[model samples]
Target: MMKVKEFMITDVVTVTKETSIKRLLEILVTNKIGGVPVVDAENKLQGMITDGDVIRYLQPKGRTVYDMFTLILVSEKEDLQHKLEYAIDHHVDKIMRKKEIFTVNPNDDLEAATSIFSKYRFKKIPVVDDSNKVSGVISRGDVIRYISTKLISDK
Candidate 1:
């Protein structure tokens, strides 16, 4: 049976809890990635952060002003804006997903990994070893490609 390691991306990009949100955004955009595993100095998976987190963190506080004359969404300053920006600049601890990080064992079957991704619709899953150290990242795109090439093509 093929395992996750057979199809996982070994060159995984990771971030630390102290990584600034601004710099995190740059890394995501530059790498064209949706999410990254959060790791400590010891390379242990601390948590995970996604683009959704970034968007949620960046959403303007309070309601938007609908201008009747110009018909536009007017921007207004709120107390949370500064706080969000500040949180992003200092570290990832403030915005990382501490509760719902989904990880898979390196020896796990690909089908099981696929099931997890399908159930959650997750963009990425951290592949970890027995010691809980991240060995690679398995993304939705990788799964799709693998299915198309290895399964569909065999049809």
Candidate 2:
């Protein structure tokens, strides 16, 4: 009956809602992490932001013009630089997943994390305390590592 706190990463990287998209990108690259939890000044959970969200937000829209004769006229694709110039200044809250963030408590069983990961395919889940303060983070890799080192080896 292992607990999430046993395998979760206590040294979690986090960001504030007002953090700029540029800074977020830097954090991701520097940390080599796919996602992070968004927290308030008190370290309370706010939302989650991931590399996928940033990519989707920064992707440039493409435009196509068609003539009445069903012929494609001008097809213009917005350049990456064009979109990044404007998006870099935006805050993470604009693109962060703010709704229905699934979380697990530090005292919860490891099975809780497995359930969420299997059901939602989440890369990470924030581990919170009784007051909703972020305590740690559990990733799919963390679960697998724990199983390899602890569970399977014991069997």
Candidate 3:
């Protein structure tokens, strides 16, 4: 049985919680990756951040409206420039998904990783050691490539 260690990408791109959101966005675009694992100084996995998260953060939220028989309340339109400036200056820890992170171990079976991805719809899973330190990362693309090249061959 193939193990996660055999297929995971060891050169994982990571970021610290203090990393600026602007820098994170640059990393994602330059690497062409959907997300990156958030780590600490010692490389311990702390959380995860994705391009989707950034997009959602930047998206202008609609103002709330409250109305009653004779009373109506509405919020004014938010300033887009202000919101963008705030988001870009904030740290990843402020917006990163810290709770309920889904991770796999390097020694775990490939099937385990695939199952997690399938069940949670995660594009990538961080491969950690027993100490919860990130050792590598495995993505859906990695699995597909492995299967295509190793499992199915022109014969």
Candidate 4:
């Protein structure tokens, strides 16, 4: 069976919990990646952050209205740009998904990664060592490319 290490991306672009939203956006755009694993200085996996998360976090809260018999209250909708201006300095921890993070080890079968992708529809999964230190990352694109180049071609 092929191992995750055979196709995982070793040159992962990771961010710390303290990384700003602005910095995360820059990294995602520059790397042309959909997401990244959040790691610490020691390279231990902490969480995962994605462009979708950023968009959800940055989305302006919808206007709300409340009525209490005689009193009525309404909140105006916030502009996206206005919200972004304030959110740019916020740290990633506030929005990064820190719970139920599914990971795979380098020695695991390639099926391990595919299983998670198929079940959760996650764009990527972090590959960690026994010590829980991030060693690499595997994306759906990576798996597809590996299948096309190695599996199908071998047939």
What RMSD, rounded to one decimal, does every model reach? Answer: 5.0, 3.4, 3.9, 3.2
Clashing pairs in model 1? 17-92, 21-88
In candidate 4, which residue ranges exceed 4 Å CA deviation?
Answer: 64-78, 151-155
Worst lDDT run of 10 residues, candidate 1, spans 70-79
Pairwise TM-score winner, candidates 1 and 3: 3
lDDT of 2 by residue, 26-86 (tens): 9999999999999999999999999999989877666455688786633224456767888
Clashing pairs in 2: none
Q: Which is the leading candidate under lDDT?
A: 2
Over the stretch 37-66, how does candidate 4's per-residue lDDT look in tens digits?
999999999999999999988676655546
Q: What is the lDDT of residue 113 in candidate 2?
A: 92
Q: Please give, for residues 1-155, the per-residue lDDT of candidate 1 as tens digits.
A: 88998989999999999898888888999999998999988889999999998888777665555676655544546546665656667677888898877899888998978888889888899998887788999988988898789887788
The lDDT per prediction is 0.84, 0.92, 0.89, 0.91
Candidate order by lDDT, decreasing, is 2, 4, 3, 1
Native-to-model Cα distance after best TM-score fit, residue 50 in candidate 1, in Å: 1.0
Displacement of residue 88 (Cα, Å) in model 3 is 0.3
For candidate 4, list the clashing residue pairs, or say none: none
Clashes of 3: 0
What is the C-alpha lDDT profile of model 3 across 106-144, one tens digit per residue? 899999999998999999999999999999999999999
